[model samples]
Target: MPQGISTLAADTPTLSAANTGFMLICSALVMIMTPGLAFFYGGMVRVKSTLNMLMMSFISLGIVTILWVVYGFSLAFGTDKGSIIGWSSDYVGLSGIGITQLWDGYTIPVYVFAVFQLMFAIITPALISGALADRVKFTAWALFIALWVTVVYFPVAHWVWGAGGWLFELGVIDFAGGTAVHINAGAAALGVILVIGKRIGFKKDPMRPHSLPLVMLGAGLLWFGWFGFNAGSWLGNDDGVGAVMFVNTQVATAAAMLAWLAYEKIRHGAFTTLGAASGAVAGLVAITPSGGAVSPLGAIAVGAIAGVLCAMAVGLKFRFGYDDSLDVVGVHLVGGVVGSLLVGFFATGGVQSDVKGLLYGGGLDQLGKQAIGVGAVLAYSLVVSALLAFVLDKTIGMRVEEDVEVSGIDQDEHAETAYDFSGAGGGAGSRKAAPAPGDSVAPAAKTKKVDA
Candidate 1:
């Protein structure tokens, strides 16, 4: 989630307690993002499917954490091999890594770095859940996550941020996870949705969001946690780079929200709460990759462009006839691209390195690197995710039954509903205790609604 590095600074390698403490806080912030995302996506779906939507994201916190402890960190950040992947015996079970040893000479311990990155790994898959809302089976989704992260996310993280990885060697500056997280997850979402197809009533049904307030709450939490996600990418703030990233993150997110609302007013003639939430997310995504290298002005430009572009991109699903239930493809994929590519034009050459963007007298070199990084992650994620979903669909079935989906997926999948609509007036419709095996209910009695 932080910027990738190949070498240590020339100063002494002594550790700092302050840096270690700062990183731990950042790691916690990043960890909160998964629940934040759950709420955001949960609020977008119909009332009947709210629990499923939330569970889709919340599950990643468990699945990815276990996998990361097992081998995820090693595959992503261990010793280099042929510039394609990484491995180290010490990183295998994390038992070999000493608690006192600093990570690659940074002030934070290896455990802190590994856990911080673990948060990134966890949330990346969670981001994809937004696009597959309402229909997919939870067990299949969990299996897909385990396979996808091992096959796709781990290697891509190596390529983008591991020491001596190809994209890292190419000098593609990903301040945070523009390529490894956003683009990777967004592309995966697109691929899986393509395989699974649309919801029961894609274009015809009234699938309006059930809770705008919850969506807004989630968006606010994401914005707050992102300060840590972006700023902590530097690992420590001794050099003041982290401070700049923090400011840029705020600036870009604000700009993107305003820009999205403006575009909405002109095009749709209304400034909706959904648009505001989506716009803020777009700005956050766009600034993630370029924040450490760009100025506040550049961040504004990045946010505005991403807000407008993503707003327009969301509409493409309707025209092209893909589902993309919550616009993950439109927002994260497009915003990641805008931020990653814009670094070539907006980079000031003073933040992270001496390299300059075109606006700062550098040539088109960085732009080419950014493009390669984007294309590589996009292609790998899309193809692999599609294949994974297809295989699972063929073997275990990804989508629920048509009638189950049309009525409600939560009852069939989770045996639970998000809300209990049966009145609390103690009427006949109120839920009664389940009858014993030998007992029977009256045939004319109405089925009472109760959350199991």
Candidate 2:
């Protein structure tokens, strides 16, 4: 355990009521991030697929919650089996765990700790929905979430955070979840997209986001919730570290947003709302692991670097021919890498841990360790995610039928649409129906002459 943390006897109650309440509030804040993600992803997809995109995120809240309570927690935070995984039955159903019992090194009850971790589990899989967007079968996606968390997320979380976990034992620093959440999900997103293939009209079609306002709303909520996500990782407010993480999270996100806008104006000729929102998320991902270790300026550096790098990275799909619908691979995976690696250069000791980085005269030691952690997690997540996706694709079929996709995934998959245009006097009551994938209207028909 880190220096200040103390292990209490099993029967002792060292719980602080104030800290417990704060953690619960933070858990609720983090819980809102899934819906925020839904809106973020929903706005990026075509109007026809909006509801399906939202549903993909919503279902994770339902599915992962149940699984977490049953056995997910055990596999993630239970007794360590090897350095790779936790014992599957140790904390099964949270059995034998006392509500009043405090987790080691924390003033909050174990139950609060369990529930806070549950929020992390919920949002991690939801992050992948952006990559698969319009083409996946709803059933296949739900199944994927269940299975992916089992094989990929649970083990990886253990490796990063569980007691006796390999990376944790190696003194690898992931304050919140740069490795376990963002990088893991981003790599998994890539694996799924590789197998499921691109959207029907990926590059050829103009697949612009349907609503910028909704995207902004989601981004705002994510920003609001991320304070909890980063700061709450401390598990208690007794120390001043939580405040440091909190400030770092805010400044990093702000710096990243500005960097993204600047990049957009220079590259695309206009500053776009999409760029700003994506930049904010990129910063959030980047700072998640390093916020507690770096100074405010270091946070800015990390965020700004992530913002610029991820902005450029979003174009990689076009160059490489893979379609990451909402730039999940670019922003999350790439941003996570930027933040995790930068810690080796910017970690100032006396903030969270007693460690210094290269710039602080710590030399190449910490930098090399960061590289090892990043490489191990990325390789493991990519391989296992690809295998899982391949098995599902071969057995149950990962995508919807071509007709269903072209017409609309929302109607076919969920029998619902995000926007109802039936009330608009556009002639037909159901004029909101999407155009067929390859359908084209005559130029004359598409053109509407208006009185000037």
Candidate 3:
């Protein structure tokens, strides 16, 4: 071979491995967000459903992992038809993907790429279910996720990420799923909340969280894992990866946290734990799409704006009478929009095979493209998600029996409790029934209620 070709071949393998390694780590980081979501939502809900909320997030770890290996990947990254769904020729467990490759400029194994992307796929829908927490049957949720992934997530993923995807062809830059994951999940959450309705005694009850510590722990894990999320988007361990994403992640989250607290202090008269957790997540969601494209300063602005906007948008649920049980729509949907649109203005020069945004003096031309892209994704996700929910409701039914919901899903659906106070002999957050106010010796069976 010529010296030039020989050198190119020698260099390619090293780059490929690095890309694969980066993506694998990034996938794991994204996976960690599921638990983060569990805690973030867990802390906002009443104590009765805390474990149930955690379980909901945990279950995705199992369900999505399996589906991705089966046909989820093929349905997403395979050949496209009608710019909607993917072909099945690459089906039966990532058959053709690992043999050849779709993405260029990186040498990672295709399976590595699939699994990494798979983690993002797994967690996105799971993030939305927080809005339906504490009420829906576990069985119903499982079925919903299975069906939703096939119908909603896979097609949207294809439209954004697949080879012939319309968005890809249009030169829209998702970088890391602002459109595909966060915005899509947020919109879907809105639809599910509309279908499922609000939690019982939503505003009337105090509905305080059972554990603040768990909320903090979840946030910590999310922050730690985000390094992988932002850096890994580079698709390789190349030289610019560290400086570009690391600062973007750090500053954006910090700006978001401060903005959230500031908003809380102004609106509610104090800084709240729930606000802190929610703000961090909002910052993370906002930065997700813009991280690779924007400068650190731009990220801070994006994070701060997302944090405050989401904090304010939470009030919309109450005003509109939508439950959105845990504000998935408020944070992710709103935050994703903030990031996506801002990238149009703030995206810097020199970070892609091609394309530049407003900051590179490319003007609003890029922003206009971004706006169109966002509209397309939003419209498609909303319509498809509503249809999927409609079908599931008519078929297996969307909710649990009213009795089961009143009783609790942990015992009813899973046949397991998140905590066993009696079994464990008094752990901090154990489940136990409290005596009725009028009872001397269990006077009225119905009067006694369990501690949340």
In candidate 3, what are the lDDT values of residues 239-281, reduced to their tens digit? 6745577788888998998999999999889998778887998
> Candidate 3 at 255: error in angstroms?
0.6
- The local distance difference test score of each candidate is 0.92, 0.90, 0.77
TM-score of every candidate relative to the true structure? 0.93, 0.92, 0.87
1 or 2, greater by lDDT: 1
RMSD of each: 4.8, 5.7, 6.6
Clash-forming residue pairs, model 3: 16-107, 16-108
What candidate 1 gets wrong by more than 4 Å, as runs, is 1-10, 423-452
Q: lDDT-based ranking, best first?
A: 1, 2, 3
Count of clashes in candidate 3: 2
Candidate 1's residue-wise lDDT over 1-452, tens digit each? 34444454676466789999999999999988889999999899999899999999999999999998889899999999999899888898897998888898577889999998999999999999999998899999999999999999999999999987999888888989999999999999999999999998799988999999989999988998999899998999799999999999999999999999999999999999999999999999999999988999999999999999999999999999999999999999999999999999999988987778889988999989999999999999999999999999999999988998888889998999998766566766576665699887678856689999
lDDT value for model 3: 0.77
Q: lDDT of model 2 at residue 202? A: 88
Q: Identify the superior model by TM-score, candidate 1 or candidate 3.
A: 1
- Using TM-score as the measure, name the better of candidate 1 and candidate 2: 1
Best by TM-score: 1
lDDT of 2 by residue, 290-336 (tens): 99889999999999999999999999999999999999999999999
